[model samples]
Target: MGLITEARTEKLMQNFSAIDFRMSIEDFSVRVLNTLTGVIPEFNKGRVMIKSEDKIYRCAAWKGFSDDIRNFQISEDEDPISADDTPKIYRNIYNIYRKALHGSMEDIMIKSGLPEVKVSVVVGIFFEGKIVGKVFLESAMDIDISKYDLYLLKFVSKVSSLFIGMKFFQERERRYHKDIIMAMVKALEARDTYTVGHSERVALYSVHIAKELGLDIKDVDKIYWGSIVHDIGKLSIPEHILMKPSKLSPVEYELVKNHPVAGEAMIKDFPWLDRIRPIVRNHHERWDGKGYPDGLKGEQIPFEVRIVTIADAFDAMTSDRVYRKSYSLEHALSEIIRLSGKQFDPEIAKVAVDVLNRVFPVIRNS
Candidate 1:
């Protein structure tokens, strides 16, 4: 029994690993149900039903059942009993299982039609310590319940609960991080009202160019973050210089150039921002090493930075600035293309052109 328990635990761990590696929920559910059925052949025709957000129990996966039962749906308040007042085996199992939650000791076999079956189990699924759902299992033949079997059920139940809890917390953490990043971007935008929608436009353009260039998922995520905080350093610059109506003098222009450095410094304490530092610092660097505080040449700047540079420029050219009118989409595209190899990475420039062409039909001039 110890060996059997160990083997089952190992298999369950493997399934959990597959789930943790980002398998689709459907696939994970199927694997879990299969695992459960494999351990107890009497459950060969068992099904796993998930309680959805709408309070509907939907048949997520099953091993065996007629087509009619396989696709069955039940509302939360609806009982599984028949109109004739006869409880089906599944309904009896659910009723008995529900009673277990309250520590009721009424024999399940007394209610179930399968009186010959001697062993029964009720397991709860929990997410964050709250019982969200349950699983029911019964023996097909007379059999004495063993300690090992009970332990196995407990282990499987605990695993399911932990997975659900982890997933819940993971989603919450993702939303929290997203909110923080958005709030930071908003704060930056609020400080410089002239560029209200700048980060969003840059993010959109960066993603488009990333897709056109066939960038990997990691690279795309990096570009997205970079575009959002490209001008974050402007938070450190004086409002008068940032919102100046006329062209910047040499001194003021130099102060503006230092923004990238300032932005980098602002986020340096965050380890996650390390991936985006290059994009923030080098978005203004010219392809020929003619732009910015650090004149990084072609192929010397990070590829992600190069991709964002074109996106940043395209958005800026087509956006209304305090000093000048925005250019038309066609004019912006032409200007970008003309600067390719000199002011922008030629490959990235071409990709940006294709992205703008396909996505924004009306590239309106400001």
Candidate 2:
């Protein structure tokens, strides 16, 4: 009996660990209930119900149980179980344990339809002091579970409950992060109304150029993000300068040109964004060391930044701006080719021209 208890304990611990390591809550619940049924030999059929905020126990995960039992509905309006309904073996246990061990309480119960099945086990899971879930197990053979097995079930329940809690917390964190990023982008958009779709357009053009260049998918995605946020530093510039109706003075132009550096600083602390920061910061740098902020020349600049810069410049020139009329597709393509090896990387400039030609075929003839 002692050896059997130890084996059951080990099996429960292993199942708990596996469930805890799962990436999704649905998968974790399914795996835990399946493993529990396997370890508890007397458990022929199992069903798991999770307590929702609506004060109802909803079906979460189940195995070896009919759809009707698995789909059984229970709500807060259902009265709590009376004292007489509690099983004799679970008399001294708490209400949670009574529901789990006896399978006859209102919170969690299992009624076997087959006459051959005589015993059933229900396990209630408590999280943060409240009974949050229950597992029902049925058996055809009469087998008395030891106290040790009961204790092991309680431990497994606690671990699985914590796993569910952590999953909820992680999902909330992801949404919070997404909300913050969107807010920042919206704020930037409000300040630079003329460039409302600038980032998105650059992203699209950069992705196309990257594909035409036969770049890897990872590199292509990096270019896409870099292009989108390349002008994020414009947020730091005053609205007057950003929306100036005339060409900027030399000093004003210098301030305006520092946006890449400012944008890099804005997103530098994000670990996932670290690789793209340099690309954002140096997108304006010229190949011949004549650009602002950093005059990184030739091969010194990152390849992804170079790709984004060409795409961004093409979109900027072709789109209508406060200080300049939109250039025709032919004019923009000619200007990009004209600046090759000086304003842009010669090789990337060639690829950019090819991409534009393919996208706007009439530009090639012009």
Candidate 3:
């Protein structure tokens, strides 16, 4: 059957133009496959798989995979297969992931003695001319792929490689920043023994709340970055007040409140962090207009910032401090509930309580 109709070609071009640059690798993989399968009749069902470090991630799939195929997962250590080995499978083995992945996916159906085609058409996704991934079109009968089809796939794969490679580098940069942020948080927290793991715990709590509130990925990510750095401004505070074993003097208290402003200033120049600044700066702001920095009240706080505030307060109440033992979960929840509309956004606080109880099963059981 002639697969690439003239109209199909135009539509494929249109679909190719729809690829989103800012998505995560897995998301991009799924979107790419969806677009391809949506427009191309020959590409009835296929998927993209990438081997990263220790795992083979079946990042995306469109129809045609059985339950076994849909459930396939493989570890790099088990097969000792390299990206260099992949083409050989397509070229010679025909079912490498099936063998390597323990009969998890396509190979299972193939091995079940299901009737199949002798040939598969695939395009290698390359970065700097080495295959990092692949695009595939599955068929039940041998495919007499045309020159136009090959060229279209090659063009699509080439364009997609740039996007995938961009996502790869973008993820690498995010990891680098994660390490730097964690180190900075560690150093800042090290100044007070009681504050160890504070940022991480707050981040965890904040993420749970963000998810429970049904926030989008970008907003959730912003919450994570903001929560982890909420105390980054404390790096500028003098250790004497930060490590004070007793209640702070009025002057010391005022200085401590300055950390949010200082932290906001420290990160304002980081373009990647521009979206995260509001959460870091206004996390201390109150719902009823009684909070810090600008004392902006109620819905005036960014919704993202409001979420972090509740998470921050919950963690702060639960974690041990130099001057006081951690509050019991029950007590902390009560205190938070009491202050919901006043100290935290009532809606966010309510959802945060549910997330803590449900997501942390220990809290639920206790």
Candidate 4:
């Protein structure tokens, strides 16, 4: 009997077509390829390739070809469909193309050390009237597959295409969110180019400190993101105050100090981002209870917030300002150690310096 009976194909199709938003594109592709090689006994190897707008074929998944199948991109490759099948396949945008490959599918069998056969069972995936991808399966037992078996392979191809389409939509949504965030960042930088890259540097510095202190993955991620947008509240301050080249008066300094509270308020509606709110609000707080806003001190300040506090200070000291030159690396590091338990948390301050030495060894210049 040929592999992939009608009943089995129906069951597989139902499961594969089910949309899963939790799965990332890479994870979804891997899951599809793994399931293919598992149930279809005759298919000793399998792969899915999709076309991009640039007229090139990109590998989305490949089992028995490489450990990481997402690496390769093939160019100058022809469609796996035959001239006779093209008319039929293109007749319906949802329909798939099937054929026996004597040439094209050899790319995998050759690399995977399978026998170079005259042809392998191949299925071309079609999504919305485009030849977006194709999946190839090589037989292991040298059994001749029945016509129905090929039909089942075509059905599986459609399931793979469904997952890929979902992946594309998910990515588009994320890019939209990212574009909005970046626009805000750009607006802030426009007012004060001196701090153009300050947020990103603080993020990198905090990530290093998180690693040095052995914080778990979740805490590390929150700290990194919070550091990147720590100064977001500064956007609420007047542009003239932010752009001031001279020392701020007491009234101007008070307004500048309200940024941490404003930053927290901006993201208060997002529960998923709650972990970061503390980090942002308390980023300016001191270890001695002398800081503004809430005056959180010692361990009372969120651990991640303390990490960012030290990182923010370091970047500010090392970075150039319109009113003054940056401090030397030696002077900045010395000042941090001297101010431990005064301006910054003593424990986090030590770890911050160690992280600096480990991550950036070039100490000749700040």
lDDT of 1 by residue, 283-304 (tens): 8899999988699999998888
- Model 2 stretches astray by more than 4 angstroms: 1-179, 360-366
- lDDT computed for candidate 1: 0.69
Q: What's the lDDT for residue 292 in model 3?
A: 93
Q: Write the per-residue lDDT of candidate 2 for residues 1-366, one digit (tens) a residue.
A: 234766877777776655444356557777777777767766665556677778877667666654444545566455242111111222222244334434444332333132334454556666555666665555555668766656656666667668766766675775686567567766887886667767767787888888988997768877876776778788889999989998789989888888888888889888767767877789888889897677888889888878887887887888778877889888999999999999899998998898876765433223
lDDT of each: 0.69, 0.69, 0.72, 0.69
TM-score list, all predictions? 0.65, 0.52, 0.84, 0.67
**What ordering of candidates by lDDT runs from best to worst?**
3, 4, 1, 2
In angstroms, give how far residue 262 of model 3 lies from its true place: 1.0
Local distance difference test, candidate 2: 0.69
- Which numbered prediction scores highest in TM-score against the true structure? 3
Candidate 2 structure, TM-score to reference: 0.52
Best to worst by TM-score, what's the order?
Answer: 3, 4, 1, 2
Which whole-number lDDT from 0 to 100 does residue 341 have in model 4?
89
Q: Which pairs of residues have clashing backbones in candidate 4?
A: none
Candidate 4 residues 1-366, lDDT tens each? 324466567556665766586665556666666666655666666556667778666666666655443544444344434321111222211112113333454455345443433235666666665666666665444556656556666666666667667666766775675566567777887889788878877888898899889997768978877887778889999988888998999999998999989988887876656778888788898999899789877888888888899988998888788787888777888889999989898988988887776554342233
Query: After superposition, which runs of candidate 4 have C-alpha atoms over 4 Å from their true positions?
Result: 1-7, 10-14, 49-60, 66-71, 76-134, 139-143, 203-228, 245-247, 268-279, 285-311, 328-366
- The root-mean-square deviation over C-alpha atoms between each candidate and the true structure, in angstroms, is 9.6, 11.4, 4.0, 7.0
Poorest 10 consecutive residues of model 4 by lDDT? 85-94
Between candidates 1 and 2, name the one with more favorable TM-score: 1
